[model samples]
Target: MTATTLHADLLGRQDPQMADVLAGEARRQAGTLQLIAAENFTSPAVLAALGSALVNKYAEGYPGSRYHGGCEYADLAERIATERACALFAAEHANVQPHSGSAAVLAAYAALLRPGDTVLAMGLPYGGHLTHGSPANFSGRWFDFVGYGVDAETGLIDYDEVQQLARAHRPKAVVCGSIAYPRHPEYSAFREIADEVGAYLIADAAHPIGLVAGGAAPSPLPYADVVCATTHKVLRGPRGGMLLCGAELAERIDRAVFPFSQGGAQMNSIAAKAVAFGEAATPAFGSYAHKVVANARTLAGALADQGFAITTGGTDTHLITADPAPLGVDGRAARQRLAAAGMVLDTCALPYGDQRGVRLGTAAVTTQGMGEDEMHRIAVLFGRALREEPSRTRTEVTELALQFPPYGQ
Candidate 1:
């Protein structure tokens, strides 16, 4: 059936309060499986908090101490957020004010090093985020960053090479993380290299923070001088970023996050973050994390079986990267067509190659109650979409999606 037909049927009965708009959006999200590695749908509770009365206040400073009046309630919310964040990540201190992961990263960099100071990090197009050291970003223009990459053969980071670069360059800080990497990063190896070079190590665990909280993934907090992440993806919260660090660096990190990078904190977002933290601290979240990783593994295996190259051979987290060019579909085109059929994923360049891969993650879908069985169906849909003729795979994928439908439908 056509989208208009589907739209009319699905949206015709929505509540009068949000009848016209709400049903159409629900149709979009319910029809599609969101696979964007960096994206996820917020829970209703989180959405409620985001649109709550907390947004009306202007809490321009930390808890208790504020630059504005009438902040008593705001103070309580911020304190709850801060305490919950520390507990969730097992950090001595947590700053939940940064508007985004990029902002948190920039604040960390600014707090750690000065302009023109040399730092070591993963190369862009090799899993590292743009804020890490992309020339187009402020991090690159403000600091001199030397990058290290993975072994060309094994398709994994070469720590020895990183050490060599560190020894030769003697940078002030070493950033370890990725946006598209599938394998687990060697934080110990990165820490060793940093110690040898007398450099600080920062882990950007934005993608795996939930898994880490759930005990399914390694905690970078134990080894990192500072860790940065977003509360939405994986963490399953409202849209915002946070910084976790040792007590010794708490003051600097906090200052950088506030007047240095942003103004008043979004108290509502903080309240939602507290809720998400509470959720992540439960055993149920641990189960969800386990399933998220398993689903990714299943999807990876299926894609590899279809002759697509799965980066790092497979995934250790909830994300999978595939080279779609071999199947005669570039990353961009595949993503667009998949969107048309009700699947949402991002086209991303591989670690060392051009834009030959499509990156997808299972966090959002798993949160929506999908499991390995659903993963197999999704993978088969992906394979069909990329492996067969477009006209042939289109209807099949739509039908497969209908089987899964969507959560909350």
Candidate 2:
């Protein structure tokens, strides 16, 4: 049967309950703009592969092998995914399991270090994710986590201070990545620091994987001993984590991901990952990455022009963190106002102060076909909402979003 007929037949069989839920979600996505730094919408092709028949399989092992029956097709799907991920990231190995970004970080840590080993990580309030070493997280509980904060004067990472801390702490690994950080870390500097302290370097490019793959940002594959990321964020794939490492450490990484960290892999997600990798390999994806960066910068500048303090001065990637105090508002107030205005972003607290900030990104809207103009316009709407009543701004923002509805609805 043809592909179109197959889709029609499948939709014909959808139950009333599921159909209503799906339709409501479609309407919600179509009517709003997603500005969260950690979120992105996947392509329809990726979605199709995610919900395909491959989910029925019980493949409990790596490709070309399985512990259960009926894995011939599953093996092919996973092998294709593995090869494509390796090629896209130019890594010696890629483990497409881990289920989530947090899982990937946990497994990489489990494989690379022993319990109670000292770990140097970015401070949570300074843009580092919870998995990096928030006291409430497993990483902090299992490991001796020492946090490094951004320079107070500039609000950027202080590598000299980091080196000093690494030398003092002699950590087992130095973890680098952020959810709200706008600038890229100097990986070479970090490598040198790690080497100086006899520590391993773990680069979590979960937020910028797509930009790195398209050459819009620096690739950490060479400098990092192991790299971990989420496929959903900038890569715009299914919700999954990937562990990439050099050939020498491939075995340990794979073992840690499988028997040590998780059970049977999500074959459907792996298949979608392969599709996402194939999509990211094209030249247009390069353009898309570039646009994401440009849109972020544009949005940052627009907000700054409205008197908001753009964190780290401006954005060098697809995200920006900004203080909302200039508009006589707090991060929570701004986030709520934006949500009511048909836009969504996150509110975050700064490390050492009562001040709060909002994180904005371009991945989702850019994936929905927005460019610099739309991003700037959205920033204006955000500014007006923060400065005025949310009800006044909600009407106009809703009108703006209607111009480019979500795809596939």
Candidate achieving the largest TM-score: 2
Report how far residue 240 has shifted in candidate 2, in Å. Answer: 0.6
Candidate 1: which stretches are off by over 4 Å? 1-22, 389-407
Model 2 Cα shift for residue 169 (angstroms): 0.6
Worst lDDT run of 10 residues, candidate 2, spans 1-10
Can you write out model 2's per-residue Cα lDDT over 300-345, one digit (the tens) per residue?
Answer: 9988888888887998999888898888888888888889888888
What's the TM-score of each model vs. the native?
0.92, 0.96
Give one clash count per candidate, in the order shown.
Answer: 1, 0
Best by lDDT: 2
Residue 386 alpha-carbon offset, candidate 1, angstroms:
2.0
